[model samples]
Target: MSTSLAEHVDALYSAVERAGPDAFQAALEGIVEATQRSEPAEVSAALERLEPMLARIPLGMGPDLAQVAGAMTDFGGDPASVLATLVERAAGAMEQAARFAELHRAAGLALPDPGDFDAVGETRDRFTAAVQVRGLAGEEEAEDLLQAWYCGDSWVQPVLFMNQRRDVRRALPQRARLLNGVRATREYLGTAGWLEGLLLVLDDEPLIVLDRGFAGTGRGFRVTIGGIGDNFQLHTMLAAALIGHHLPGRAPAPAEVAAATDGPDLTPEGGIRGSWNLVDHGGKWIWNEGRPSDIPHLDGVRVVVLEPEPYQRSWNAGRAYPHMAPLLRIDEPLSPQEAAAWLSRCTTSS
Candidate 1:
């Protein structure tokens, strides 16, 4: 006698429980194959023949058979097409089952309990929001930020230091404060996880943070923002200029880093020579009084040290140089034009 639909489903579920997701998929494949082999009339006759048998079995196979039958009809009596649809659906179900199984296995292997897995979805949403900000800001600004903060030679050492000293989330918040004008305290409110905290940076400086986020890879808060200010702008501007010069199709330059660094050096007239030192790293020149000053000569002007750094070194190993040194001394206070020109030259050189 033909096996009842209810009996088949009972066996299918039993196989699923005993042999896992793979067996469940195989059972689905078997059902599809059975459907494909029988003619429509023959399949109908078999269903009718097994109706009584189906009623006798305890498992709920009635709905499954009916659904399969209905699907066959929907496919315009193409049993093969119906089988294909069934296989596709079965594959999707098997995938879900496998995922759940893996999740369960992971739960068993120490660490956190499997409490609803809602956080994964929530994290994805936050990542999407962060990405959305990047989309809203155009590419040029994004590239500028990335090159300045994330890429190039000088970024490596500072990035390592920041990573060691600060938590990723906290550092990110500070960076947001500087770049986006958002307060660090405001950005960190009720932040739960690292990913969420990183997203909070975007919440403050959406344009700046988001732009850089796009040009990066990895998961779980990979972008570093803390030391971006010192060098990122210069690198970004230079990269843009290089691209503009080299690539015909790329976007125009937004702004240049030279604007920040290149300005006239103001010193006393008749070339005041004093010893100066490289006091700070932010490209500021400072010098101290009481020292023989041999500064670089240009345009009948000599550079003097305005601020002092007693322990300093110049290119000349034996020659004593100003601790806080100046590079140029313009007659009188430097005019805006002279200052601009001098700054332009310094910027171009440095």
Candidate 2:
């Protein structure tokens, strides 16, 4: 087995398989080189190697391409089935990656530079391991857990329940903020990300506001405005929250809550504006992050807004999106009926 493309493929997979505790650097470099070349046989061989671990790769970033391609091949028996599987599984990986980052930062670690994920590309191996790396999951369990993550925003429930390590799953709610973070983390908030935007349909109002990240544990537990300081705060909150979330504990003490507040938000956009919209899409609730105009058929649907939660101190840039322009004012966890009544009773213009 000379160092053909196939060898590179194997080497890349081996890197993803994690040759050593810190072999990530070498594995990443090999992956970069492997993607630059075109060797179908080697790539095929590499794909075969990944065939077994295919279920587990998305628990980290090293296997986006591989997962999709592998699904295509495996789905040869039932193409539609694999297509559906890949779509949902990809979504789960997206959210889990975010949760992983939330935990990573909570652990007092710096995020890897974007350059670290540059090796990701169109090919199988390159795609397989691009956006994530190996996390705590093994092959057999990874597929189910990862898929469950994307299936719903409350994915943390299943992930937390499935894994015995409360310490790891506890990180699912790092920052208690909206799903906004690095590429690996932020990507899950929309598109490939699970949990659609929040929607509020108001009567006599010009806009039907929507906030994509409203109340899903899929969003981190600790929220940030984009600074190490915020993560530090979240770190403290996580310690307490994780304990309460996982173990039997009371709410934050008065002293602890009072001491929790830090200085004013340093990020731009002047902090939060209002509570997010929880739109009803069919029976499922979508945290709509789109513009009111996006749902043109809905009358007077002028704009969509990302309503802030005054009770929450974490940072959320969801409002910055121009599409989420129309703001809807409502209390926390407004029920669908309440939102409709508030909208109907609206006496003033949006």
Candidate 3:
């Protein structure tokens, strides 16, 4: 709705006299530009203009258009209708699947299911009754919390984005165990709607995008765990951190993460245990008594180990790891010294 965006869109509209490869390229560029400027409304406007031309677009450009639409959805644009048009225009199953994936993720932007809202009531009851629950500020604070729940359920979510040299499917044992642990934790958490993902080449950079819905309340807790060396290590640490943030929980101290790494994996069927297998290393707690030191999920829930070789190749080829756009970002790349320090932290024993 901004005047500048209006002007820009007008320019693009004027330039696209007919539907052709050049027109598709121009529209794609417009969407990308609007997205880069963080103008969601403009992105929507640009896509609206392009949607009518979907039928006329060359079959070869279907994938290209779908790719930009996917990126637009990530950046807050509503491209559902446009994506639907592209999906129908797709020439094959692979093309349809690609377009559908973007459509599915965009669907996540809608309000969460009514059942999901039930958690807010539980949170309210517990929060109201606890006289000394952590961060309790009485009735006003409770109201704020309720309002947050009311605003929407499909808000910010956690995702692990990686660019590496190895396929995620063919992970090293350590990374495999960590991946399994994460999937098991999600299964145990009963978050059925969580997404299982595949490797993708996005924006000319290979990426592994794994994401799912996480409650807003669960995210405000500070991440006390540190000492990360690789994507695998970071993912495992986040699992431990999230577990600690849940009820009857507290964030794992840095020392605990340090201790947990290189430790035995958390295997259920009498398999090898390693860092993925979380233990209470007895670190100090910022909130409650902290996560129980006992091993968890021994029943052995089914887990999906995401092997990320596509991204691994990109990383090994000297490409920087892709940022988790619009949600998480690295303002700058790690320098040699900084990278070495992380490696040192990972290598050093507790």
lDDT per model vs. reference: 0.29, 0.34, 0.34
| Per-model TM-score versus the true fold | 0.16, 0.26, 0.31
Alpha-carbon shift of residue 299 in model 2 (angstroms): 24
lDDT of 1 by residue, 278-344 (tens): 2211233422211212123334332221123244332211111111111111113344454344433
Instruction: Name the lDDT of candidate 1.
Output: 0.29
For residues 211-270, write the lDDT of model 2, one tens digit per residue: 223332222111111111122222223234433443232344433422323323223344
- Shift of residue 23 alpha carbon in model 1, Å: 0.9
- For residue 181, model 2's alpha carbon misses the true position, in angstroms, by 18
Query: For model 2, where is the 10-residue window of minimal lDDT?
Result: 220-229
Error (Å) of candidate 2 at residue 170 is 39
In model 3, how large is the Cα lDDT of residue 212? 14
Best by TM-score: 3
RMSD in angstroms, all models? 26.7, 19.5, 21.4
Model 3 Cα displacement at 285 (Å)? 31
